[model samples]
Target: MLYWLMKYVLLGPVLRLLWPTRVTGTENIPENGGAIIASNHLAVADSFFMPLHVRRMVTFPAKQEYFTEKGVKGRLKKWFFSGLGQIPIDRSGGSAAQAALDTAIRVLRDGHLLGIYPEGTRSPDGRLYKGKTGVARVALEADVPVVPVAMIGTDKVNPIGSKMWWPRRLEIRFGAPLDFSRYDGLVGDRFVERSIADEIMYSLMELSGQEYVDIYAARAKELAAADAAGVRPAVPAQPSAPVAGDAARVPESKAS
Candidate 1:
């Protein structure tokens, strides 16, 4: 009821009139059954614009803080986001990551479109960053297709720290669905997981035409913070293991 009111009666109509949105390749999104909507993170508005145009209800795993705020303004935000079909989960890492994965799995099992930003955070410089393998793990565990989406010009719609969205044209492009059937039953393999994630990122890179950076967005932000703090950040000697949300799945399998 709230979803319908927001989409048809309220915010959706207002957004359509305000922002000129262009969408393409929507046919790539399956009309039914479970699928992952894996997209590049841009502005926070990316979440709003994607679901507004799509016919299916797209649900995202949002940080709990969005729903847990205090005061009247916070209450309004909570209500608005809940109506937007977002579920709150802890994103602080470790067990919280596992819990988030569990929630996403539940959403998929219920035959809903699960929207995730494999890059974890928005790009600091509008370039595509390395995707976390958690998306791969989710798809594998849920046994669903991964649909890559590209949202262009969203960063300009609502810039990094802006409270209000300025009118702008945004593009939402959906690429072909990614099939990982050949690697079916190999969910616990870290190498295979990274390969799948890389393939998805490659597709998104092509769709968005953004320069690709091999580092995670989180790491880049950390480095940027360190630089501003006038402290040198230590670079890891080797790429850390892909500790995605459900890495325990790896231990359940016998090492080959």
Candidate 2:
């Protein structure tokens, strides 16, 4: 009820008027089944604009800090996100990471549209970054389709480090759902997971028309921050093998 009230009556109208997102390919979304909406992380506004344009409720894994903060403002943040059906997640690695993944699987199994940023964090620059394999693991475990979603122009509306929003042209594009049924029996294989993650990122790159950086977005941010501080950043270790295969062969989509 709260979600409906806020979306339709309270905030939706205002947001739609302010941003007026142009959406396409919503026909690709399944009417009643669970699926992962894998989107590129560009800005904070990606969360709000994506949900605003979609018909179904999108459950995203939010950083645990949002729900753990104190004071009236913190309380309000918790209330708003909770009411929007976001699941609190601990980004710290180890058991907490596994726990967050488990929660996401449960949501998918229960037949909900799960929204995830495969890049893990927003791009420090406006380019797309390499995706984490967590998305692939969850899709395999929960047995759901992965739909590539492109959120365009959100970075302008809510750029990084900007405290307020600006009215900007926004668009949300949904690509055709990707099926990984060919790799159905191989869940725990890291190579298979990496392949899937790369494929998702490839689709996002094509849809959003953003330059693809092979490095992780978080690491890129760290390196960028280090440069700004006049400090040298440590070189990241290379992966065991190159990231290539079917993902590379996937055809690019026509961006609007």
Candidate 3:
């Protein structure tokens, strides 16, 4: 297959030699079975180096724009990512979220590795942002352990707006699998989902040794862009008291 050839034959040899990439805790990965590898997104290279070091082919859902672009350059990008076996996701709204979970469930059911960036997008700065609940949803739905992976120094390899790769020391550290089986029956609870996502992000913060930011990465980016545009960002509204019939009333993972 193209993935096998790329990992073992073509690109693998070249990458391992050129960049100072090191992967640890690979033994933590189950040899077989569906598991979610929740990693911190630092740079574009995080996608490439993470899979390059792992023996098993780790597949993740990528934004569809990468595959749908036109022209020669676009064609090459599409073919390369498709050949790498990544799923193309719409990333539009709720429908895309459901579709992603559906695809992820199928991938997990097929006993393949699923790589996910809980932060949703790469960090604008090096700090780790609050993880989206989608990752927790996938793990709970698939009934698999969530492994926290920290990608170190990848930002230096491919810094923001830099097209060329720099020969920098990088590492991929995988932590012990996080079991969220306790919240299986309560996945629908938004608070429980938030707790689970926060727990995963906490583990990533420890693993990656990056400063933790409570705000979501997307929000941070939006605020940064607004600042660049000389426009003030609106303040987020506070949450009201829990509704009478809310299931989240029951305390879970990190409700506080």
Top candidate when judged by lDDT against the true structure: 1
lDDT per residue as tens, model 2, 147-172: 99999998898989998999988889
Q: Write the per-residue lDDT of candidate 3 for residues 151-184, one digit (tens) a residue.
A: 9999998998999999987888999988888776
Model 1, C-alpha of 147: deviation from truth (Å): 0.7
Ranking of all candidate structures by their lDDT, best first: 1, 2, 3
Query: Model 1 over residues 33-126: C-alpha lDDT tens digits?
Result: 8899999998899889999988999999898999999999899989999999899989888999999998898899889999999999998778
Q: lDDT values of the candidates?
A: 0.86, 0.85, 0.83
Give the worst 10-residue stretch by lDDT in candidate 2: 247-256
Q: In candidate 3, where is summed lDDT lowest over 10 consecutive residues?
A: 237-246
| Model 1: how far residue 256 lies from native, Å | 13
Off by over 4 Å in 3: 233-256
In the predicted model 1, the residue pairs found to clash are none
Best by TM-score: 2
Q: Model 3 compared with the native: what TM-score? A: 0.89
> What is the TM-score (0 to 1) of candidate 1?
0.89
Model 1 segments more than 4 A misplaced: 230-256
Candidate 1 displacement at residue 176 in angstroms: 0.5
